[model samples]
Target: MTVKLRVTQLAQLEMAALGGIGLLLLAAFFFQLVQGELPCAFCNLIRVCFMLLGSGLLLNRIYGINPWNYVLSGIGALIGSMLSLLFMFAKALPTTKPTGSAILGLHMYTWTFMIFTAALFFCLVMATLYAQRDSLESPGHALDARPTWHKGVIALFVALVFANLVSAFLQNGFDHFMAGGQQHYRMLYDGDVMKP
Candidate 1:
């Protein structure tokens, strides 16, 4: 094939890959919401990065006919990758009784981990796209690109993640894991409730 045709093919593939990343991120968000778990600080940061990269790739798919489309995608991918690395390093550290959505650590939300992984995965995909991006709109014939396997992967990831969350909550409830939180303390510890 001609050099121009080859470049176009690569671009299409990159776009499909970006789409895969977006779907994965979306799946993670859906899982978190359906599970009723709230995102903590770190989680929110990760979400922002994912949104940035995801939006960037999406814009490329939309207005990618322009050369600047690749530039936008590159910037978004770089930012997303940097943010992902920061959060991953901080979170990978041992858990420390994290309070209320700290940026350093995540909460007990299952989506916390899932979203982190999702963002990182998307960032990686975007970086690869930057390395390969040439024509922008898509690599090849968008209609022929089958992403069935990608969907399967995302479904499995989210289901198992959310299932784990439900299991943990159930175990905690059954075992009164919040016993410490349930403790009753008096302002004046005279004897019992108060001194006579």
Candidate 2:
């Protein structure tokens, strides 16, 4: 007997979480490039977490691996969200000493604190959903008809990734792009830096 499911609880959630994160990453990068805000190592790490978590959710949709997919998303969300929060605290703590150029009269840490706070919130939401999610029903319940917002988010994510890719390649020349250089950006961030 062959059973089919489309809009299972987990799948719906994966879509929503991925959409939110995707929109955020896109918005963040565009804001950075347009506003001339630079991403410190920590910011970039958080970005990577968004990308990984987004990817994991996407993979879940296609692969239906269930446990691994949700687990990966949850763990990534937990770790990445926490990492962003810690960076926020570290940056905020040093403000008492006072230093560095303020962008638009605001310190970089100020920007990071806002970003991390939002990311943490989303990560928490995704993690909780993942934990409670047990099964996936067919996608027909809600997704079959296709909601307008869902489509918008998917389009936005594609746009964000495409923009990020092009901007990344052009700025860094495809290698050391985000490092404010042009040789080793694609090599992935160093692990030591990820640890607190």
The local distance difference test score of each candidate is 0.46, 0.56
For residues 44-100, write the lDDT of model 1, one tens digit per residue.
444454455445545544444443544554455555556555555654657734323
Candidate 2: what lDDT? 0.56
Q: Which candidate achieves the best lDDT against the true structure? A: 2
TM-score of each: 0.44, 0.57
The sequence of per-residue lDDT tens digits that candidate 2 reaches over residues 73-168 is 556666675765575566566445422346677754455455545545655565565455465433323434556765676666667767665655
RMSD of each: 11.8, 8.4
What lDDT does candidate 2 reach at residue 90? 66
Residue pairs whose backbone atoms clash in candidate 1: 11-138, 11-139, 12-138, 12-139, 13-139, 41-101
Q: What is the Cα-based TM-score of model 1? A: 0.44
lDDT over C-alpha atoms for residue 86 of model 2: 72
